[model samples]
Target: MGAHNGVNNMHEVAPMEVSVEAGNFQDAERLDDDGRPRRTGTFWTASAHIITAVIGSGVLSLAWAIAQLGWVAGPAAMLLFAFVTYYTATLLAECYRTGDPETGKRNYTYMDAVRSNLGGAKVVFCGVIQYANLVGVAIGYTIASSISMRAIRRADCFHTNGHADPCKSSSTPYMILFGVVQILFSQIPDFDQIWWLSIVAAVMSFTYSSIGLSLGIAQTISNGGFKGSLTGISIGADVTSTQKIWHSLQAFGDIAFAYSFSNILIEIQDTIKAPPPSEAKVMQKATRLSVATTTIFYMLCGCMGYAAFGDEAPDNLLTGFGFYEPFWLLDIANVAIVVHLVGAYQVFCQPIFAFVERRAVAAWPDSAFISRELRVGPFALSVFRLTWRSAFVCVTTVVAMLLPFFGNVVGFLGAVSFWPLTVYFPVEMYIKQRRVPRGSTKWICLQTLSITCLLVSIAAAAGSIADVIDALKVYRPFSG
Candidate 1:
């Protein structure tokens, strides 16, 4: 449409700003400092973007993650992760501008930041990891949204047929349904939170998260008190010792995945308006706000969910029938989940869409198929965007079909990206940009943090991949 605040051209990354190089108006006034568009993002909007990014279906798995870690380590692990995420995120905020906190050249994307600072093969490495993780997240959202969609029907089935019916359902059809929805939303253009659908989705994020927490509390009270063990699921008849180790390691991945929003932190920061207080300071404030808020909710949901079901907590807090009796409530929660995930899928995938479209535009500047926009009602759509975005959705959907287990996929994605995106890149970029003296105390501390997270990421990845392999032994993707 006419610059839907949701799909405003401000998000176009200023690539073609040369045409408007005369200056001014990303729908902005005076062109601000960069001669592109006057930036308008504020601390609050940045906070919303971070919240929407961080708190999604990931929270749904924390109960299971805690079950693996247990009472003693579950909450402790979460707190540790909260600290790491915030610390690294602040370090990253500092790198938004290359040389100075306030005056350095702005790196519009995460790729741009790495390219400007790290250069060399590392830029390629960053791109591969960043985009690959984006693809993995797209697949994870497919699996997750489908699970929520299928849960809706199963919840009804259990209520109508009684819990004894088992009410089994396959996620295949639901995943396809989710893919179809994404294709339509994908065509809407831009993943900025200003979009109407995005705002609704953000509300749904809070809605379901609160619902999960409430359900956990209700279940805990219904059990007369709490229900788990200090050590979590015990290794005896039901679980082998080897299984215990793998599950615990996988739990770290799941938690890491929950906090995996650092990859797009710079993209989110790019939206902030030119400021006297500086984007870094505002972003730091927003990072603290978003992380603190999500962490509190994570703790409430994870600990209470573990307390309610103990070692036997469901892998998905909402869909796993952890609160089976309240059928309507379960439906509501799952619906909220699907809605949130629908938006989350688009939000996360927007970067991939932009990168490809930009490349195509660069390579074939005159091809109508590459450069033309087809009008639909009030809005203008690109033929290329339509084709590629739909194809991407389909690819993700099929991949999700092959590997539908949410926990393992989420963990593996997190493990693969956590060390690189969240910890290492940020730490290295900060060290280089700030030029902490070689082998200095600050340098040593940052290196230690990076190394520790690398180990964690490695263990988590191994555990997730093992579980995936084991799952493949008996599970067939499209079997009825």
Candidate 2:
């Protein structure tokens, strides 16, 4: 019940830090004097938050990933990742409840849950990993958004050049512009208040995804059928088994990244206006709806995209769509993607903001912003807030500019974080919190699966990083 109210005010404590000092399970629940539920969001809005987090720039790469495995392996991998992610995500949601399902204590943030079950040391470790992953995601959004914007402009240039000269648009300026746009939304108070933006982002995800699928279908029809060499069953004739295995690993990483909302599950759940007892059910419903909705889009977009371009599908599906006949549609799709990332960037960044601001206030209790007293004129803003938030945005923007390869960088982050943040932590936390016996088959299977996922993700992450380094040999910093 001590959830953030989602709106920032001069008088109230930020929800992320509200109960940190209470030091007990019972204190985790913050209720009004009347003893009613205090959370602020409903099922629909919470689902939208999950959807917005899960289906970001990652969706843009699915076609290229699916192309790695051909039609047979790709869709199957997509379904497998969705199923596993949803199951593990629900396990994490159950961790929020501390006693009887009908009456239990609840933890608001992911670190709160970790501290409760794993102790303070583990909490510190988790914080480092969690914050790093979030910053990585924000950078990924900046890179992906800039790429989308540049794609549209480059398409325009192609026509102007009569298709005889190469397009010369640059992505650096747009990356900074995207960062500036994110800074505006990042200043918005909390997770709950941003529901409208999340809703719009969710809509834009579907819009661009739909547009991609539609264009793919039309292109396929015009071309008479699917065009790639190995669109049916086997890998391309020249693809070595080693190459196929490597590509499959990358594809799995992409699917894992696409389904990753586990890092923000509790934060999103905390936004739902339900008591601890009903929180699990609410989260289950929200996760189910979100995973189902995005899965449909992922499959359609992946399949149709592969069908349209086959081996030719670029790492980004929209960029590969290009400015063909009826090129305006491609432009519209790119714009929708840029708009969606603008919101997605903020949703992921808000938690990082909360974490940083809370720590600074705790360390310097007399600070202007932490004092609950409003300031005016020149003293209107907290220097801490302005300085750190701007720094976070700037850091991410610079990273994106330096490492401009979208698919590889995002995949590396996803592969590295997916195991611990999404799979391993949830399963381990659930087992510890519920006291699932080590000898139990269910317990053994879960641990084994978690370990397997971690190993696979590590290999994928390493491969992704190596691929990025190789690709960077020819990458110009400001080139489109």
Candidate 3:
């Protein structure tokens, strides 16, 4: 398809040029010291992007998932997932490293890199999948955020003996408001704003974890025993083995490695500017930071939640933690979650918008309104533009809201969406380009390993899809 401009021409962009034109740089000398368009981000900016990306709606469910796998398996799975995520991310970096440097400079997007190495059809497929996943993720986050907000409000009401169903009372209004806010946040012009948001989220997370831990300790001391001492904690006589199994299973779903790892890889690509050398180093550093930060956070949160609630930890761990005393702490945590989710939405939203913008430019060359400059307005105002980016966000948001119950479905879509970008396309490109040389056995072995990793990733994504389908069946009525 030829490139055009405007919303109507979105699908007409040739997939090969997706990256080159995404952040069109006309005067590199003016923007960079080396005559290349300088990237206006640093190490921390990359870390924040990766952290926000890795921590999302899925994080709220970590305790529940870990409960299913038990403490040992859950943490182990997270570690393994982190490793896989890093490895695959490295593969993507390698692809960028070997790409045509000139083309890389022009179209540095992930899709452009894939298209340059693979073909048009694969690029298109990857684009569609990526778009679908981001939209699903945005919707899921919005719904989950609404649910969390409602739960907190309801708890507040109940504490004062007030009767109200926060879920039913203002659910629709809150959801729409959240969706709008999410869109606005996603359009923030630079990393400075996002960095501040990330700091807020990090603070909230630490505060929530600390409060939960304190309460658990106090409860133990008050009962004349150390909490989690096994002997000190009382077990309910009526608790059954089956119930424990169910709780553990639920926890396992949250701590599942595949989904979490895939997401980290996606963030690595999204936040960093792609082109070899630069993209490679950025991806490597970002992946390391994301994994390290997320792993520590998950472990700390999981331990604290388990200690505080014991076997009674709610299916959504964050909800249970919020009930811990120091009401202000909980309030901060709530706000933090909201802020973090906003950041997540921005990271997800940008690429979708860029893809749309690229397509629009390709389809309608005459539409000056859809040109890059026109699309680069304030985040809120920019959403109204008839550009591919805006159109994708609007369409995705509506679909996501309509399918609010499809949490697993959204996760599955995200995993699937990441495959071509993070795994398959990268490996294929590396093999085809023969950048490593065919005569070397080490290179062949590396290729085989890369291929194996992609296959495993696909399998993992497939399993997640199955889970989503099953979840959809169980929650069909809620879809309305």
Query: Which candidate should be chosen as best, given lDDT against the real structure?
Result: 1
lDDT of 1 by residue, 411-462 (tens): 9998999999999989989989988998999999999999999999999999
Count clashing residue pairs in model 3. Answer: 24
Instruction: List the global CA lDDT of all models.
Output: 0.86, 0.77, 0.53
Give the CA lDDT, 0 to 100, for residue 359 in model 2. Answer: 80
Please give, for residues 1-480, the per-residue lDDT of candidate 2 as tens digits. Answer: 113455323123224333345564244454421243455666776787787778777888898888887787788888988888888988998887666554566677888888777775778778888989888888888989988898888777766766677766788999999878776566565665676777788789888888888888887898798765443324558666666666667777777888888888887787666543377888898999999998998998888888887777778888854326456777888899998888888778888888877787789888765545335532324566666777889889988999888888777887878888888778878998889998899999998889888887988887686677768888887665
> Could you estimate the TM-score for every candidate?
0.93, 0.87, 0.70
Give the per-residue lDDT digits (tens) of candidate 3, residues 47-140: 6556655655565555444544555666676676566566766666555533453244333456666666777788878677666666666777
Off by over 4 Å in 2: 1-37, 227-244, 275-277, 321-323, 368-380
lDDT of 1: 0.86
Better candidate number, 1 or 2, judged by lDDT: 1
Best-to-worst TM-score order: 1, 2, 3
Pairs that collide, model 1: 1-379
